[model samples]
Target: MSLLDEKQRGAILRALHDLRRAAPARPGEQYGAPGNGSSLLLSLVTVGLVFALWYVATNVGWIKPLFLPSPQAVWMQLMDVASDGFADASLLSHIGWSAFRVFGAFVLAACTAIPVGIMMGVNRVARGVLDPLVEFYRPLPPLAYLPLVVIWMGIGEGSKVLLIYLAMFAPLALSARAGVKSVAIEQIHAAYSMGASRGQVLRHVIMPAALPEILTGMRIAIGFGWTTLVAAEMVAATAGLGFMVLTASKFMATDVVIMGILVIGAMALLFDLGMRWLERRLVPWKGKA
Candidate 1:
């Protein structure tokens, strides 16, 4: 008995060792997963390389200053904008306006689209009704509808927000629908077997299962909101990063154009990072099959 017990324990230990060797610490992750530090270092290196290339190109006159401003020129313009303001508004005000427009539209879209998407995913009638509308408009560019929106809403903040909201809606809706549909049938069956009501199952299972996709949709929707922002702001008046960039372009202020572009990119990047952090917090089980 003692001998048998010893052999069993050795076998179990060896099996555990083999299992550890065969599987990644996080299942479905690559064998040599890069930690957050590694990813940050790589991102920094890439940014540094791009900056170096830009500096060298400008210094060597590979690209004309008019067409491609030097880093120093753009940086100087940034400082000027920060201190003295541009287009009758400070840099911070421009950012604030843009952020307001983008986030406001995004919030509205998420509120409406997520529910509509879930309905479409779960109900045949809802799918029939809304899917056609979404598909019909999804392929159309914001520019195509810009004039109509301006005519209807009359060059105000209402029109601008609506344009961005429309741009963000289809993607958010589609992502939610996909997420709901992707929930495992087995899970649904098990829930039913355990006496779960339809509402309870949805609340407890479907919503959680669909959350990652919904969050992903939110991220994509925000990106679309930003892309449509330039067009939306074009309708109107003033005081946004998009407006600053467009105004600069008309005056042939390439340095300001570049600065505005960099600022927009940085803000978008930061929002995306926030979305990623939110995803990790809300859907920790994602990609961890």
Candidate 2:
């Protein structure tokens, strides 16, 4: 009564078995995985070592005060900014503005890029039309286009958001396109053989299979967007971490510059960690066959 012959069923079972065997031994653990506790400890130790070197260098005059302020001086500057504000705005306000711009651009880029990338992957015409354009812009740095954006959109929020959006768009689109292209042909064939419609196949098979790569792309895009934030905010911006940093550097306020750099690095690290957690939740079989 079964549609699949005995040989077909056996082959399917064997394939499933092999897939399981090829999977990682545990969730979040690949080959030669280290213990989580050990990893955390080692990371903390490395950070401490770097800080110690920084303190010693500043104190011993191995690095000039102008070039690298002491840790104590930087700490005092951070406290001052927290209490008195920087560049006519509080540090928190600057951070808030920066976050708003980055997230706005990132969300817009993700929404448009994912769908367009998926289309490009599935339709040859779409790929032919868009691929050359994406490839051309993808390699150009954000600063290269900043002047044009400012000229067209003005040095307002529109230009800032557009700059970051352009920075994020390419990576997300390319990643999604690559993900779809990487789908197993046999899986598509199997879905079709089961009488699934094109919509059903795309929804249940292609999208799910491609989600991990898409998410990875999103993480990369966010990094690119964040890196472009300084350039974005440098264009007639008054309230942003980038604005604060640029303002401090102009005044030779090394401490403020360092604090801004640290804040940006910390925020980027947190976002990256959050993305990794989301990827694990959404694609539990990411590393599994």
Candidate 3:
């Protein structure tokens, strides 16, 4: 070989050796993974940074107090609402009312949607009947249906609950159906080969397999339900966090408005955390290889 060709061959061999040495011990090997402690620390740092920014912006008068209240001002308003009450109802009472409406509608949606979704997945008739309806209303914004809901159900608790229920139902049902459709055909065949009855197969095989998806659907549904709360409470509500926020805004009670917004966000965060915890506990095998 010529001198340059010999040098090029040596360089290629060295590069291949280096690349092999740097490769993972096994295919798909993960490295430098952060532990739970690292994750928690990062979360805390992010929250601290956000609060610091908020403090600096308000304290430095970067934003008008009328438009953006200081964190301290919002905190004081929270204390006032807790003690003196907002619109003759305590903060706890408003929270309770909002929670009641959300959970009520959510539970109703879960009970109905899950079964309908399973039927849709398992039976062509059900799919043909319900899929069109679900697809139709799912795309429409909640506000589009609000006037009709109010006219039909009147401006009462029934209307609010129904509106929230409608908001939660479609996504949940679709999730359940998708879950059922995703069930392994081999699992169904195995159950049938073992002489398991239809009911037995559904209960033991289908339900467990579909539970993770159903729970995920529930989480998404609750989020939608919460989003619908302000719209629901706009319908003649006497006591709710939404009502409190809207009432405060009319008079430009900026602190109270910010406080109410914070309370709603905090509650939603807590509930979401609870749902995540439940999912981890109940669906331990989810996403496992």
Each candidate structure's TM-score, on Cα atoms with residue i matched to residue i, is: 0.90, 0.90, 0.87
Model 1 per-residue lDDT tens digits across residues 35-132: 77899999999999999999999989999999999999999999999999999999999999999999999989999999999999999999999999
Instruction: Note the Cα lDDT for every prediction shown.
Output: 0.88, 0.89, 0.87
Ranking by TM-score: 2, 1, 3
Specify the poorest-scoring 10-residue window by lDDT in model 2. Answer: 1-10
**Rank ordering of all candidates by lDDT, starting from the highest:** 2, 1, 3
- Weakest lDDT window of 10 consecutive positions for candidate 1: 12-21
Q: In candidate 2, which residue ranges exceed 4 Å CA deviation?
A: 1-31
Runs in model 3 deviating more than 4 A are 1-32
Clashing pairs in 3: none
Winner on TM-score between 1 and 3 is 1
The candidate with the higher lDDT, 1 or 3, is: 1
Misplaced by over 4 Å in model 1 are 1-30
Please write out the lDDT profile of model 2 over residues 138-249, one tens digit for every residue.
9999999989999999988999999999999999999999999988888778766765568766876788779999999999999998899999998999999999889999
**Candidate 3 CA-lDDT value:** 0.87
**Model 3 over residues 90-123: C-alpha lDDT tens digits?**
9999999999999999999999999999999889
Q: What is the TM-score (0 to 1) of candidate 3?
A: 0.87
